[model samples]
Target: MDRRKSLKIIGGSAIGIAGLVLADWKWQLADQLTHKGFFTFNEENLISSIVDTFIPEGLPPKVPSPDAKPLGGLSTGTDKFLYRLFEHCYEKETQDIVKTQLVNLDERSKSEFGKPFYRLPQGDREKLLISFENSEIEDEVNFFKLMKSQTIMGFTTVKEVMENYRGYKVAPGYFKGCVDMPSQA
Candidate 1:
């Protein structure tokens, strides 16, 4: 073939290859974004159990009030909140760390108590979490702290907790002016 024809054919082939690679990359990226939020069904259940342990249901009122009904983490959808938070807000490294730690927690529970974390008794679950909190491994300790803080944050921010447990009024019905201010003592 002549030089010009040969060069033209080579350049066209290169462009075609480049276009195919780019299209493939785009499709892969779209697939990842679409599937990103999903965790295995077992993982979801495990997270729910962990959050419930952090704030178990049917806590007694501190002041023995008949009207009080303490809200628990799972009851408030804290586990679902945590899942979204991790998927959307956390960095990829942090998300991976959390997933890894969750698996590790289950493995540790199985080895220690002969059951997965979600199947362990409440007391055993608490004991396992306490061990994580006191663990010398930095990842384990960090995971415990992160889970505890996130669980509490999610539980406290629920609408039921705000209205019932905290007596949080969105708007005060009356705002009395301090007309009769006490004299400076």
Candidate 2:
């Protein structure tokens, strides 16, 4: 299949969860993610690296990666992109899910590879995520579901992917109300 087709498939299919909480209007809490007190840079970088792993900057199988821009993934700011979604969009219980998932992933990586998730080689990182995606382990399953959804959401917003793959119009004309025109007698 073509690159755009692949992007659509990936974006549409990754959101495997039933009731995702994505609030477009309530983005104010996103600012808190960048704070040092509540959120450290180390955490953000780790999350970002995981996002990058989910969709890496390389040719897939036999398909050539886009030469113009990095097709999708962390180059689009997905590393810290889910901060708002977790902090604001998700309910308290769901927020706990996010935290628990990240921590579990870090621990798993260290236990398996003797290094942090971000420090692993790309192949190993992908293998770990793939294992989680297919694993029956409760925490792994939960993290995969959440990360896949958020990563796909962030991937589609990357400028190149939005325009080239999804056809997002950055400068579309203004919206006007559909008013009934006076009927001709």
Candidate 3:
């Protein structure tokens, strides 16, 4: 083959390979997210929303939101991310426990609080959340500690949480040792 023709063929083949690699990577990611072992999208969204709200979304003066940008309110997407991460970290049974407990808690919230767990007014919501925070739910099929820990973990790990609450980044690429961190520090 002529040198120019050979170069063109080689370049084209390289581009094709790159494309395949990218496509495969994306497919794997989607598959992982769409078909987690324990948590379904609905369950995750439900839990994440509760967690975010339980934590609340706001940036203090000179700080930013912890997990995402402060776009007037919270992002449901961050909850999903945290849910996925939690699912990956724990066993299937463990995740199921958390899910079941969350559902139970929602039911309890309805009966005890007289409102949907997520729909209660701010003060009532805060009081209900305080109850959850103070005591772990007991069950043969649930892990209340895991549920509570995961909620806190998901929110606190988010960059927006640090930025908003403490004016910090959860995972800054470079560390600035000299900055005197505040409450979150």
TM-score against native, each model? 0.69, 0.63, 0.51
User: What stretches of model 3 exceed 4 Å from their correct place?
Assistant: 1-42, 64-73, 136-145, 159-185
Residue lDDT tens for model 1, 150-185: 989998889888776678888969788867977897
Ranked candidates (lDDT, high to low) = 1, 2, 3
Q: How accurate is candidate 2 locally (lDDT)?
A: 0.72
Q: Candidate 3 lDDT, tens digit per residue, 83-108?
A: 67666877776666677766766777
lDDT at position 27, candidate 3: 95
Instruction: Supply the TM-score for candidate 3.
Output: 0.51
RMSD in angstroms between candidate 1 and the native structure over all alpha carbons: 15.3
State in Å the error of residue 91, model 1.
0.6
lDDT (Cα atoms) of all candidates against the true structure: 0.86, 0.72, 0.63
Q: In candidate 2, what are the lDDT values of residues 1-185, reduced to their tens digit? A: 59999998877766633224344323434744545533355566667777887778754343334465444476666665676667667788776766777777778889999998888888988888888889988777887888888888877776767676666888889777897889999
Q: How many residue pairs clash in each candidate?
A: 0, 1, 14
